[model samples]
Target: MTSGWVFEEAAIVFVSILAGIIFFYISSPSVKHEKKQQLEEGTSLIINFVLFIWAGKIVLNIHIFVTDPLAVLAYPSDAHAFYMAVLLLLVNIVYKATRKQMYVGTVLSALVPIFLGSAFLYEFIEAVWNDNTMSWSHMGLLFILLILFLIRYEQIRPFTMTALIFTIWSLGQTILTFILPYTTLYGYMMSLWFLILVFTISLIALIYNKRKVT
Candidate 1:
């Protein structure tokens, strides 16, 4: 990868983490817990996410690392690594919460808002950095999502809210691809493919959750 590309990736990671931390701090007042508890939990969550990303990077580049231990840092992570890190973090959270018999909805509720903010910020930054005018529209949708989460955070189940957000985002992209047909991001069609997969999976999960509840 070019040095410029590496710098961009590193910038995205740095800003996303900073934005997440700021959002988490802002939402701390919304959390129903003591200051000490919030600090402890926040610290744990940060550590978990950092480790998750590190693990994902190692897993994806193990062969390269085995041959050239110092070369790993030169390789920038892509969307696959981000997705893997997210998957691992989610799995870890589910496992620990279930093992401890913690309230699932409550755990999710506490987690999702911070994520919503971070996701919005990351996308916004990406849009500006990449000079994608179409992406600003997508960023507007993310803004709506963040507002919705903030407004309904206490009233909805975490999993339900999360599913709803995923569905909305996926559906929005599906619509955007048609509405804005001229836009192209290096011909990767990232939004088009992501819309298909996310919409299908989220719809299925939403249906299954509803059926199970009923």
Candidate 2:
């Protein structure tokens, strides 16, 4: 039963990501090819982000990984791994950007939309398939983000809109957690602190980028 549940969850995640990528791919041309490599780079970053989270999960359960790697892989990852993985993902992106002389804002512009789309689909699926009412709050916020993206994709100022949406989503989720403590994000029990941290980080980035020219 547990294995089946895990498989089901994995399937949902895969489908959500694929849908997000398709959306990203389609939307790119609508902008008259303004954003280059957005889809490809976004997909690559998403893969890296997942691998980082998986690595964090394994590190937290090194004994299991050493003994029965298959069992470790089958186990559900802890929610805490997300926090570490997010920081690591940022670091990795910055490191690559500096080394390759790439613009961080471009990466963020691509990454945010794909990530937002996947998140919305993930929450929407959970709400329908798992009967998780707590996902409604997240889905609503994500929907707003999607609509805003549609409106602003053409004139989007790189990190400004992306970080703004992140701030909004995290803030909304943080409030929702108080009203619904059983709230789950990405199939794990929601963490209020995590939401707050994400909010702070995004807000700071938004302010920083808005102030910085180009």
Candidate 3:
């Protein structure tokens, strides 16, 4: 019918396709063993994905049922949910596919760009569909990348390199935020926090590695 209706329909179809992809990939027999190990590792990536989807749906319903400016914030709810869902899916798929590798460095090298690219794509999608404004929450994608890096730190030197990049990005954002005070500055602050967390994890990994070497 109208352009607006067309866009809405397309968005719905895209989301449906994404959900199907996640379901099929996660349920695949090839990755079934890795999924079991990941689940046992206390990393609730799948659970978080499901929760984000449920939260987005609930927020959308609340927005529709209520009449408030606050409700409109839910307009980006689906964007956030989709971002996380795609991220977790990507990480799970990569880890499962690469788990058989003897060296963790190979896994890190293979996954880092894929993970970062996925984050960029999610932000690009948000810019196109939800709001033209990109927020720091999108940086959560980087945090996911860092988490994966740290989890396999013993086997990956690239984790150190990625941590360095993350640190620089975080510090740069913090500096820019000081120069420009805006709502988006919050995103910079969050990025700084994420970077700090990454650094902390990296430090721990380094210390552990050194101790073992000694």
Candidate 4:
């Protein structure tokens, strides 16, 4: 007989795969008529991100996974898993970009949207599944921003779009932090930090592009 845990495990796997595929598709530079190399690079980027997530999970709970392989599938990843995944992904990207003499700005710009879109969908699913009312408003705004992203995906470069989306998301988060009584300030410090990072990167990219044009 099928059990709840089995379904939960299946759902988790499905969501993870779906997130990867979505990232690959939406972030494909050719989707908006960019070069074929961009599509290939985007695919590699998403694949590396997924692989790192799985690897991080295994590395963090090797004992448990070794004892019960099923536990690895059943256990949900936490913030540490996310942090590890990002760290590994950054390392991979940096190594490849440096070795190949690829454009660092282009690579990073492509990554940010994929990250935000994947996070939005995953968080929305979890919030709905767990009946977390506190997250509903934030997720709702995220959905709208995601829709806007889709509508304009082909029109803008990934970095500019990523900056726009992150800025909007950060604004929404700030509003939620203030208006929602249950919102925790400690929980939102990361969002603020991310906002600053996005703004800084976007500003630098703009300045660099302007200098290159002139």
Best by lDDT: 2
The most accurate candidate by TM-score is: 2
State the weakest 10-residue window (summed lDDT) of model 1: 182-191
Comparing 1 with 4 on TM-score, the higher-scoring candidate is 1
Better model by TM-score: candidate 1 vs candidate 3 = 1
> What is the lDDT for 185 in model 2?
62
Task: Give the clashing residue pairs of candidate 2, or none.
Answer: none
TM-score of 4: 0.60
Task: Please write out the lDDT profile of model 1 over residues 1-214, one tens digit for every residue.
Answer: 5667877766775676667667756764454464335445544665787677667777899998888956775666655565677677768777878798444554555456555666667667768777767767667877888888778766766577778888987787687788886322221244476567878888887888888878
Instruction: Give the Cα error of residue 50 in candidate 3, in Å.
Output: 6.3
- The candidates, ranked best first by TM-score, are 2, 1, 4, 3
Clashes of each: 0, 0, 0, 0
Instruction: List model 3 lDDT by residue over 44-156, tens digit each.
Output: 44344556554554554665637664444333334444544545565664675577623444334433443344444444555566564644444553555445544554454
Give candidate 3 regions above 4 Å deviation. 1-75, 78-111, 122-156, 182-195, 198-214
The per-model lDDT (C-alpha) reads 0.66, 0.79, 0.46, 0.61
lDDT: worst 10-residue window of model 2: 28-37
Q: TM per model?
A: 0.72, 0.90, 0.36, 0.60
Cand. 1 Cα-lDDT: 0.66
